[model samples]
Target: MLRLLYVMTLTVCCLPLIPGLGGVLLSAASYLPALGLNEPNLDGWHAMTSWPGSGTALQLSLFTGVTATLLAILMTFLILQRCWGTQGWNRIEKWLSPLLAMPHVAFAIGFALTFSPSGWLFRLFAALTGETEPYLWSLVQDSQGFGLILALAIKETPFLLLMSLSVLKQMQVDRLLTASRSLGYNASASWLKVVFPQWLTKMRFPIYAVLAYGMSVVDVAMILGPSSPSTFAVLVWQWFNDPDLTQVPRAAAGAIALFVACFGVLLLYRLAEYFLVKGWQSWQFSGSKTYSLPGKYLFGFVALLPVIIIPVLLVWSFALRWRFPSLWPTRTTTRFWEQEVGNLLELAANSLILGLVSASVALVFAIGCLEYRDKYHKSVPQLVIAIPMLIPQLSILFGIQIAIYMLPGQWHVPATIWAHILFAFPYVYLALDGPWHSFDQRLTQTARSLGHSAWKAWVSVKLPIVLPAILLAWAVGLSVSFAQYLPTQLLGAGRITTLTTEAVSLASGQDRRISAIYGLIQAFLPLVFFGIALAASRIADPQRRLARHADKQVSSNELISTKPNH
Candidate 1:
């Protein structure tokens, strides 16, 4: 049964890549049976490269992706250097989950709300200057994509910071810091000289994920990116949506091109890491000239954004009248919420259903794979599992969509759910990786020895211990599914709508109140689940039991030492 289950898990998580890539290659080659163009040709590729502004779009993607990734990495490292072990770190941890849970769509919207020409900041500036009009200067939809880069950088920082936690713990950062300080290295120098390299190495996959995400991000780019050419991925998405059947091949070719771009960038990043960290030993031992980042303030600002954005969205959602240069809405009501209450409930239900189903299924598949590895002494590799996350969604989904059309029956809903699972599985598996490895197998062995079956032993012993991590992983999966915009948009065939899809769609519309309502709700649902997970994890944590056990042991040992006989 375990072997069978493992095979099923592999089928779900790994095997799809074959058909996905195959279908894409075929479509890119102009072998489209549905379009009656079964002959292989390179016309699609020709059209894609020759498309006006394709060069500019490609440059935008690369520049924005690489730059944002670098900034996020730098910010994450500096934040760690300044506050990883400090009291401020505790507060940062409290903020990480919700901040991490804020979807890119919502983040982009909030960013625009705060920084656009007619946004709140401009309003404030106009008010202070005694001007009746908003400023013409803006960040959103800039021709240079600075806004896109900024949003991507800030959004990815929290993720890198969270991943840094596990890496930092494993590196025993405190001891490293202590040794570095003894050698005359200051706090900044110690972190830079001692911790940054290790953190970078350990965070390679996450960095890759972020890079791919930044490069392929569609909704966020649409919200804040330039309109002239937009990002390459967005262009491909638009191409795929073209009503002309002949454009499908060109779109497929673009997807393949995007895949190549992501693959090349990831490879380049790997080589860079190798050269910077491993190929040269000089940098590791180089003089520790320290420079402090304004990390405390920077992180405070980054962490405080959601606190501000949420209220702004809330205020906009309820605003009946709010003019430029006014700090507060003149009037507010629940009319907007009330008007959309039914639609809101339906969207919420769809989102909840998708999140619950995908997260639960992904969690089970993750558990199965882990168990199979333990029982059979074999498993798929981490990279294979993470392929879904590392590759551009546009690339894989294009081919997957082709495959769906090849099928005679309705595959949209099933395919979307499967895509969500495939993407979320990597996170789920990695989340459980530490816990499952650290889990004491002896308890299970003891249970098995005392007349329990393997399954029974696992259920009675292993499950309880990892329950906290399991819940946490589930919460991660839920957020992942909730934040899915591309999969739902592409695979749902416009027949399905979730809060993420609606939020992204509304972001493009002129209705800020409606957009804010959706964005706020979209942010709220995932946060609720995450809050529950954290609270439940705390309640169920095995550490509490172990700590209590240690306290009793300490008391008994002290009592024995101070006995009257002594």
Candidate 2:
């Protein structure tokens, strides 16, 4: 039964990638039978290559993807070099959950609200300068992709920070720091020379994840990217969504081009990692030359951007006509809320059910995999788990959708939920990997010696101890599920109406008010789940303490009973 369960879990969780990849390749090559294109040809390839300034779009995509990912990595390390194992670390930990919980879509919307030319910043500038003219600078949709880079950098930094915390914890940073200090190295030098190499080596998966996201992110790019010749992924998406049937080949070609782009970038990352970190062994051994980074100020700026943005979103949510040059809303009303309340409720319910179900399912499977790893001393290689995360969602979802059709069932909510779980599992698994591996096995052994069954030992000894991580993983999964755009759209066939799908579709219509409302509500879903996860973690900690106290009390009572009455 155990073996069967393990096989079933692997099949369900990791086996879909083959078909997903195969389907996309076949379709992109013009072999999709469902679309009645049986003869494979280079027409798709021609379309991909011959489009006007297509090369520029692809170049822009690569530049934005790599630069944003590198910037985020730099920011993450800076924050850790300064704040790890300090008082600020605790505060960062507290905020990390909320920050991670905020979906990319939500972050992009809030970013636009603050940084767009006609946004809150411009209003402030107008008020201070007494100039009726709003700022003319095109910050939001600038042709240079600066806004996209900054937005992605800010959004992905928290993810890298979270991953770094786990890696640093497992590395035993204190011992390393002490040894480096004994060797006469300062804090910054110690980190760079003694700690960074090892940390970066272990962080390959998360870094790949960041790269994949930056390279292929569609929703965020749509909001903040250049419109004249949008990012490659967005251009491909437009091709796919084109109403013309003949354009399917063009879209498929674009998807193929995107796949190549992502693959090339991944190769570049690996080469860079090898050259900079591993190949240069001399760098680690070189004499220390202290480098000073303004990490505190960098973190302050990153934090302050979101802080300023949230109020803008809230104010916009209630504004009826808060036009240009108004420091505050010219008129405010609750009507947006009242108008959206009913539809928002329905969307919220759909989003909540999908997020809760998918995250819960993924958590169960993650626990199973972790337990199997612990007992068997064999692990699912990180690359296998990272494939879904590191591959562009648009690149593979079409293939997966075709595979779903090949299955013996009609597409419905269950299929959509399953796709969400498939995507969410890797994240949930990654989130739990740190805690699960770090758990001491001796406690389980002690429980077993005290006559607890294996299952009982897990529940009473293991589960309680790692329950905090489980909750956090659940939140991570929930956020991933909530933020899903392409998977739900492709798999759900427009029947499943999550906040993301609604938000994206509404944004296409370019109604700022409607889009803002949807964006705020989309942000709210994960916030609610993370809030519950946070409270649950705190309550679980207290309960474990109480249980420990009760165990001690019982032991004392037994000792008293054994002694004489005096």
Candidate 3:
């Protein structure tokens, strides 16, 4: 039964990658039989490449993606090196949940609200200087894509920090710092020389995820990215949405190009990582001098940026009439909320149903895969499982859409939910991996020894111990599903209306009130699940005292050993 379940899990979670990739490949080669283009040819690639501004679009993607990733990585390392063991670390960690809870779309909306020429910043400048002339330069939709890059960098920093948590915990950074400091190196010097290389190496996967996201992000890029040429991902999305049927192959080819570009960027990142850490070892040993980072201020800025963003969203949602140069909404009303309340409920329901169903299904598959690994001592490789994550969604989504088109039924909900599950499973699996691996098998053995069946032992003993992690994993999956825009938009065929899709669509209208309403709801849905997960984790953990004490001890050890004289 377990083996059968494992097979089923793989079918549900992993097998889709095959059809997804194949469909995209065939369509890219202009061999889609459904569209009456049975013969394989390079016309699709030729058309995609020959499209005006295609090169510029690709350049935009590369520039914004690489710049954002490098900036986020640099910020993450600086925060870790300077503040990991300090009291400020607690504050940073506390802020991580909320910062992470804000979806990319919501953050993009808020960022535009704060940074756009007519946004609050300009209003403040106008009010202070009495310069009523409208500003010409704009960060939102800037030609160079700097706004998009900044938004992606700021949004991804917290995620990189969150990803760093487990990596840092595993690195035993305190010991490294202690050992290095004993050799007459300052705390900053020790961290730079001793801890950075290993941390960077371990951070490869997270960095890949970040880079892929930056390159392939459509919704966020749409909100904040330049539209004249747009990023390649956005261009591919536009092509996919083209009403002309013949353009389908062009879209497919663009998707393939995007996948290749992202894959190339990932390799470049890996090579850069190797060169920085391994090829440049002289920097590690040649210097006792180390530069101090303003980590506290950086962290404070990153944390408080969201705090400011959320409130602006709220204010905009309620404002009925607000002119430029007004610091606060001059006259506020709930008219937008009143008008949207009915549709909001339905949108929320669709989002809720999809999120719950997909996340639950993904969680089950993840659990089954983890159990299979434990029982059989073999499992699918991590890279295989993470293919959905590391690959650009636009690439395979075209293929998945083609597969769905061949199915003989209404597939909007199922296809969307399936896509959500495909993407969500890897995160669920990763979230549960640590807890499942660290679980004490002795408890299950003891239960079995006491006349329990294998199933009974797992249900009664192992399940309870890991239930908190499981809940958190479910929440993570739920969040991933809720935040998804591309999968839902493409697979649902515009029949399924969710907060994310609505938010992205409304953003183009440039209605702050409407955009705020959708963005707030979009951001709120994930926080609901995250809150439940946090509460459940606290409720499920019986050894709160021990856990708290262990955390304290770890913090103390890190502080004592790695505390820098700043």
lDDT of each: 0.87, 0.84, 0.86
- Candidate 1, residue 61: the lDDT equals 95
Q: Candidate 2: worst 10 consecutive residues by lDDT?
A: 1-10
Sorted on lDDT, best first, the list reads: 1, 3, 2
What is the per-residue lDDT of model 3 for residues 72-171, given as tens digits with 9 covering 90 to 100?
9888888888898898889887778777878888888988888888787788899999977658888899999999988888888988898787777778
Instruction: State every prediction's TM-score relative to the real structure.
Output: 0.93, 0.94, 0.92
- Ranking, TM-score, top scorer first: 2, 1, 3
Question: What TM-score should be assigned to candidate 3?
Answer: 0.92
lDDT of 3 at 522: 89
**Could you give candidate 1's per-residue lDDT for residues 1-566 as a string of tens digits?**
77776777788877778878998999999998778997999999999999999989999999999999999998888788888877888999888888977877787778888888878878878888898877776889998898889888888999888877777777888999999889888888888777888888999999999999989889999899998989998899899889998888899999999999989999999999998888986877786566565677779877776778888888889989888888888998899899988999999999999989999998988888888888778876877777988999989887888888888999998999998888888888878877887787889999999999998998878887999989989998999999898889888999989999998888898788998888889888998999999999888877887898899999999999898882
Clash pairs of candidate 1? Answer: none
Better of 2 and 3 by TM-score: 2
Q: lDDT by residue for model 2 over 1-566, one digit each (tens)? A: 44554565677666767777887777778787777888998777788789897888898899999999999999988898898888988888887887788788877887887887788887888888887876778678789899999999988898898898779988999999999889888889888888888888889989999999898989988888888899999999888788875657777778778888898889988998899887878988786557665587577777777667666777888888887888788888888788888989898899989998999988888888788888888777776688788888888777777778778868667778877887898999989999987889999999999999999999988988899889989999999999998888888888888888888777667666677788888877788889988889877874778989999999999998999876
Count of steric clashes across candidates, in order: 0, 0, 0
